[model samples]
Target chain A: MKRFSWDEMMNRYPAFFAIILLVVALTINFILQPNMFARDTLNSNMRVFLPIILLSVGQAIVILGGGIDISVGGIVSIVNTILATQVGLNGSPEKMWTFVFVSIGAGILAGAINGFFIAFLRLQPIITTYATSFLYVGFALFILPNPGGGIPAEIANVYRNTTPLGLPLAFYVIGVVLLVWMYIRSTRYGNYLYAVGGNAEAAYETAVPVTWVLFSTYVASGFMSALAGIAITMLSGSGNAEIGVPMTLTSITAVVIGGTALSGGVGGVAGPVVGAITLGIIQNIISFSRIDTWWETFVKASIIVVALAAPGIINLLRRKKV
Target chain B: MRKFSISPPVAAILLAIVLFLLSGFLPNGYGSDINVAIAQATNIVRLAVFLGVIAAGQTLVIISGFEGIDLSAGSVVTLTAILTYVTVKGEDDKVLLALLISLVVGALIGFVNGLGITFLKISPFVMTLGMSGVVTGLIIIINHGNVSGKVAPIMTRLIARPLSPDIPIPNAIIIWIIFGFLMWLLLERSTFGKHLFAIGVNRVTAKLSGVNVTATNLAVYTLAGALAGFGGFLVVGNTGVVFIALGQPFLFPSIAAVAVGGTLLSGGKGSYWGTMAGAIVLTLITSLLTTMQMPDSVRRMVLGATLLVMISIYGRQRGFRQ
Candidate 1:
């Protein structure tokens, strides 16, 4: 019996299995529909996927630290509402920038409150985040009852029309996010996070600033969520309370499919990025296949289940030596 | 219990009562608006019944030492409802038959979940989540997202129409009480039930003592599925509809009942009675909110805040040693 490193075992787990499936999905799409690989289509899809990509990554951070955030979707909704109303209705472009700052600030503040309860007060992560999700989304609804508020044409143009060196601006945003994620991984806090999830008692034994590390990850997640929310405002040009409701489910699915272990120790940004794209493509697959509009939910749900389950089956096979 | 006397959920019930009374006396307070409160309460009870039913199974699953949070529960509910509707189809004589179908579906779904988590050794979170999505999707595919069929007239009369419609009792409430008692007996008094708690307290310990861990896991998920399936009956009875989205709402509240009732998310150590109490507390709080004329956002905010406060107080620690 060879002693297996956690990393080696993780690679064989269901989380990684799903990531492999995501790759196969994209490959199949390209092989079957060569046009689907066109830069224009890919760019547009990336734009739609950006918020989810950011959100999944942010959420994965918290989950990695042995916590989960149901509130990411709610936070995004809140920020989207604030931005749409402020940028579209009341603020000058300058004030809109201020609005963006304030809204993101609101997200951080809300997340910190979540952190306070989970980290300091010792509430279960699932319950704490679950309750906060409603709080944030309710606040969003309070601010913007309808999806009437709209971003300025210029902001919309940035998302819709802009490219840098022939690459979509959305991809550039991904690039930036990837850079930030890399920086996060480099921080001592990152190491502490991995430790916390892999073995909390051992980390505590080592005297890690466990609580603060936990606190900061949530704050970072909030920042990403708010950024995602603001970007959505520009892309959609309107803010609707219902706009991000689906993201809650989709983000977690994306994170899981990206090969981030639900157990919270292994996996990272690349897998989820691929995972989000595969999911975005799944919608396109349904439409292109001309599956009845009726079957869309069914098909998507099936895909989600299969994606979620495959990893576990793979890990089981590996573990059982069956 | 004289030794166990008061539970967190019991406290929450008392708190809801106090708040309800306070709301009645507040300046412009609307808690005294009885008819409206009852009407609104019917909806919550409708939901609470579905959640409480699922939580009953969750309590069992948790008590089996698996950290078995059934994310797939709502899916099971949806599956059962669709099966019931498609099979029963307003046939008063066949309602019992439809219910039987529901149990089979529950058992099958639970079997799949058990196979994955216990036999295959998949993590509870991932496997159940996959199962959840798959089941929900199955509902959509079966119904095509349409609200079809009629509840057997008697069921509609007995369950859906509520008590005079103007004074609705929500058949869901009736089912909740009857089943609640059934669950209490199964969990507290049965040899099988004792085995479940023993396993949940520690799988190794139970295994060492000759408890069949796999069988217990199977029983837990299967029962959970059955309860959730029954919940589907309550859901359709309450809403008189079956869309892809209907079952999603119950997911959070189902978990909320468990979490807010002092059940450790980690397996073992729980009280289903406490869960029912939590459900009541949730029902009363939401009912109290309805009496007040506030923005939807504000209502959600306050509703959420109440949940957080309840969980913070009741959910802080657990008896599950591990």
Candidate 2:
């Protein structure tokens, strides 16, 4: 039992929720068709899962560091616009790489601005991020008023065309991210992040650089946002102001699903990563179930309701035992 | 005089106006006409009043803590507005019925939000956000994505008329101020209000000290919902037509107003009066943006900056102490 709990551990983070959703997804896939687990289905499911998973991971890190970012979606919109308009600005592969750097740079710049205000200026994270969201999305609209800019044909084709042998290059990239995250979580620095978020005054008393950790978490979140934007650029084939519209809340949903406390600390990358997959599966199951598109937003929100209410239910049930 | 420390939010509002004037003084194009400037100010005040009414209710809900919020305020407006237009459909005699039904609808939704938060033990963030989505779905379903019908003509006359023609004050402002005074009395004086503040300050302590934690929370949320609904009635009069995304924009700004006005996000110490001031500050800032000849981006950037400054100043005053 201990080994089971330790190995596939984070799965137990949202134990009831993860199980319920998995059962639902599996039941839907089976009723729909037995071939639902095959290559094409897997590819499509993973594709939808990628953005949320990336966003959630970043969200988890920040929340673990005791803050929230309502600006992730706005950041994605800004970065996606950058990739759309400037992805191939230099025309050469080497120059195009520079453009990518600039896109990432934009993310860092945005994150840095957020950090300065929240960390140094002593602003509340949510309020600072909320205002910045208005600023960033408005700026994105200024840059690209409409969804007209097309990615290089080759870039769009990359996401569209699947490989028989490798499935998708995006898969490898995510796998690398997971491994790196796991490695980092084992480091002492990661331990400090938990301490900082859990109780900043205590951490400061113990000599942890609370300010730097708080600031860097946002920067780290920014990088993840940039990566997600790049992936979205490949998938959407064009840039629009609304592409990342749902991302902000979706990221939070994923993190909470992964069992990170909104009060901060007490979570890891595994929960957010799994939560993202769970969300993807839920979306896939919903799309395959003949629900209208209008109801889709409703369903996404219902999952949040269920996810939120379930914890309370559990806490209440355990109250009797206590 | 000692209490008048010159709040940063108020200062930000003043600065935005000054910037507006500097961009184009009274002798220039849009600013040349007194009636026009006053007219614009009235519209901004109208918007601010509606936002303040809902935000005042938001203050009570949040003061009970439990990760408390009432994001559904916006959706309440949407649902109530849709219902009013459908039921009244422009009749004067039936206006009271429409208003009563809307109040009931708002209260019912608020009751559900409170029940889920207190009884089910859901996080206020996710529960309210999910409810917002569900309410939004209801809005879409009822209206079929395009708003049709009209408010009662009597309501249009009584609720929409300006109280002061000299300043061209919106009738909504008059309604807002009267009700807001009632809210202040309820929150700052009543025993129910005392229980709410205690719970907000520390739910555990309040419960240990014999406060009916669940009841206070439930009542607060219910009050918030009804107030939001009533505000929607006023909104219908102001706009004279309903739009789908009408309530969507108010959610963040309401929260912003509460925070900027010096309400701690954690709850307990705040004023409905300050929230009213906060809303006016935000509206005045937005109005300044309009009077200035600057492009939309610059205008938005300034707005964002003003919000940040306001939040920071309040945080300082509250001694948020990272």
Candidate 3:
């Protein structure tokens, strides 16, 4: 029989820690709300988390490609604004579909802008995205100065109530996302992503399409952010200029918790997806536990800090043992 | 380091002149009257002071290298302002004590961040990002979402008042000059400053060359927090009210100012004067946009596009060299 080692398992699967966290959070949530898995409650919860789950997958891809996209939220805001204003409160389904396509296109355009500056122009990923974020949010604000416009009730209800095979509609979306990610991971471009993120110079020397790979990651992130925006708009059943601001930091936190390294070339979409859900569950636990409203942000942030520091602390301990 | 070429600071000066000339086309142009120019200059200086102070610490951390950035600066500023106002409670006599306490609190937070980065090996980006959340949470907890306090009369006058009838400069401008000089001395004159640049250039080599890398990192982050706290005080003085969102806008502009000032986001290779110039340029750009009666959206788009162009000039050179 082969000997088992915790380190080997962690090395082989970077999501180990995140998986454990998710299990713990989910168990606590289940205990708090026994009916959490019930059809209605599950659908509502899944509906809310779906946006972040999609956002995290995109963020994970960017991080894996050895860059960070701080403008995801801005891109999300743009999409939300597009849908809210174009579809209006009483728009028909045809108009909604048309606007949805337009919103996605807008997201791709925003991502392309970021990618051109960072990948082709060779700007710092963080700074370039930070600058572009303002451009996106500012544009969103221009599109909808106030937070009043929203899609029709029927569209939102479709998002909220849809269930297929007794599972929430989000489950199907998640399934599709994972399937797509898996397929991409098996492709040559996927290998190129990891190689470039690990070391762009090394990858370039080995003849990888370094710049194109870099560009595509941001585009992918943009598309994902657009999806997240649509989900959020549907979930809220309204539009706000500032809706996407808070999501940016949360998405990054989710990426970190998912066991992805900020230095890049490690972790995957699964970890971040789990990380996003874990974050959502943690929020549920907090609310279910009846913590003070004031302490909610503090407690959640402290939890994130702890989560961020855990791997580093564990590595130090391992090194000491060695 | 190389043959003479136009650096960012020089470029900033040139840009300032071009902007000034362009502003001549405005109905109330800079050259229209001497008094108008002074008023405009003072306004720009006043706004730049807040951004410059926050960016000052950022410059130090970024100079110290290792992908150093302090995203929590804006949150710290907000927290410190709230703490200062609440503790002082509009009492002139309590200002000094409140300021001291705020500084200490800021330092403690910074120390936690440093500890996480140094001992736990957390990524600076993630650690600081988490710290921002924690600080914001603390603000909410303390204020319970109902912040109420007035800026101390003396503190308000200290920043807003003119130095004297003979001197047209506001006290804020004088204070900024002192802070700017001090930052310049720290970055260009001090041994710690030298070590920072060296470390930013290459951490292992700096460590091998006898730099106390850990100690330096700790000190820089602590100073950054303290400086951010001080910025909080200045902002409160300027606004005369303590609110959660007061310091929010400073977050990106501070970083942008540092980048616009020509500091390398990858760490090291920049100057404080460049940052000061950058801050002024940004404020000028905003003011000019407002003067032209452009909507907020257009202003933001212009700012974002300009930032992209600026970074492209700097980034292309660096990207190609590597």
Candidate 4:
């Protein structure tokens, strides 16, 4: 039998490092707040992290497809604005449901626009999405100019406080997402996605539907972003056009920390899922550590930087030793 | 014979002129008064100069390829501006010292970024994004989230004040012209330019062809950082105030300007002249929108849509098989 090598293991399971990092982060959080595992604490923490987790999963898929969707945040903003405005604070539950579907549809439409440009028109992904992001955010601003509207508290409570079988609502959502991802991963479309991302020309030559794969990734990202928008809206019970803007880079960071290569075709959604949660936990650790409030942003950022740079730095050191 | 075609830079200039002329029809815009028009034009150019200076670095980074981008440019600008303000403390004599400090700090940050990307093999997107976070945290810690300090009088005279009563032009414009010229020479007329293009086109091939890819990349990033630092100094001088997140707004616009200028985001081909024109075009659009008195939401939507349209027209990538 061949000996197991660390490099080979990492290559085979890109999320391996993310899992380790997650455990480390979780332990630190537990130490800082011994009751971290309590149902209430876990629910609150998971509720807050759900949106970014959703966003990161979508971003991972896009990265896997050899593209990126900077406009996802814009999509999130649009959905949030739609929900907050159309649903209103005291709107009927029926009205909220109607708007939820409408929001998702709008996300798909916005994503389709990005897809058309990048996949069909063959525009550069980064720039095309960057430009479209402005449009989406702008539309969001148009929808809710003052950031005052919100979903009914009754509806928001469902997303915030739901606990089934002693677990948070977010746990179910993540489970369903992972299950769906697994199903997708075993399908022909999934194979095609990887093939295209690994090498578009080769995939094209080998008769993979490269254009369709590329297009679908952005659509999926848009869909996930809409979901995230909804989750975040529920958590805040309010809306703001600027809320989603900062989340864009954070989602990207989570995906990278999860070990998904930006060059594409090398990672999966699980890593990003863990990475996003780890990020949230890091924030918790920062707060619980009793560090001065001024040091929070710096320490969080430094930790992320280290996380991003660590894998590469380790490889460099290993090579030098060899 | 080659077909007659206007280059991107020239076309951008023409578009800016047309936009300016169209804006004249709006109420309180440049209507029927040559002096007002000249004044408006000067103001547009002056504002564009700041963006141009920032975009200059963006152009260089984008042209260096391998998904090269400096997401940290904005944070560097913010940090440097604060540092300069604190150093100068409204004294003309300390302005030079402030400049030196800003450059060194910016360069140091970029060096770390380059080290991570070039040596540790971190992705440019992740490395810079994390670095921006780190820089943001640093800023908060340094100032405890409070910003104070005043622009030096001489610095203001150089950046914001008119050159002379008769000339009615800011000294910043003259400085930008000189800076642009030097940048043009660096990108188009120097051996370093050739190496940069080579590395951008194909890193392995460039290495095989005797280009020092690592050194060139490091230099490009360092230069970009230094430029952003200088931009920060100018920004404080122009605004005559210091604040946290001062550089946030410039991040997207800098990249947009580079794209509009016809720099290939995939790297290898670009020019600073085009970026200058792109900055002017962007500034013109903003001025026109403001002149029309469109609400902020509508303005954002229009800007996003316009960017998408413009990029579609000029930035289409080659088909996969091609």
Q: Pick the lDDT winner.
A: 4
Interface RMSD of each: 3.0, 2.6, 1.6, 0.8
* Residue pairs whose backbone atoms clash in candidate 1: A14-A311, B64-B200, B65-B200, B72-B132, B163-B169
Which residue pairs show backbone clashes in model 3? none
| Poorest 10 consecutive residues by lDDT, candidate 2 chain B | B313-322
**Chain B TM-score (model 1 vs. true structure):** 0.86
Docking class of 1: medium
Candidate 4 error regions (>4 Å) = B1-4
Sort by TM-score, best first. Answer: 4, 3, 2, 1
lDDT of 4 by residue, B107-222 (tens): 88888888888998999988988898899899888877666677789998999989998999988889999999999889889999999999989999999999999999999899
Sort candidate 2 into its docking category: medium
Which residue runs of candidate 3 sit more than 4 Å off their true CA positions? B1-4, B28-31, B90-92, B147-150, B320-322
Model 2 share of native interface contacts: 0.45
Instruction: Please tell me which predicted candidate would have the highest DockQ against the true structure.
Output: 4
- Per-residue lDDT for A148-201 in model 3, tens only? 899999999999999988899999999999999999999999899999999888
lDDT of 3: 0.88
lDDT per prediction? Answer: 0.76, 0.76, 0.88, 0.91
Candidate 2: lDDT of A217? Answer: 89
Q: Point out where model 1 deviates above 4 Å.
A: A1-19, A89-92, A315-322, B1-6, B23-50, B65-67, B145-148, B156-177, B238-244, B318-322
Give candidate 4's error at residue B71 in angstroms. 0.6
lDDT of 1 by residue, B113-158 (tens): 8887876566677678777766765666677646567777777777
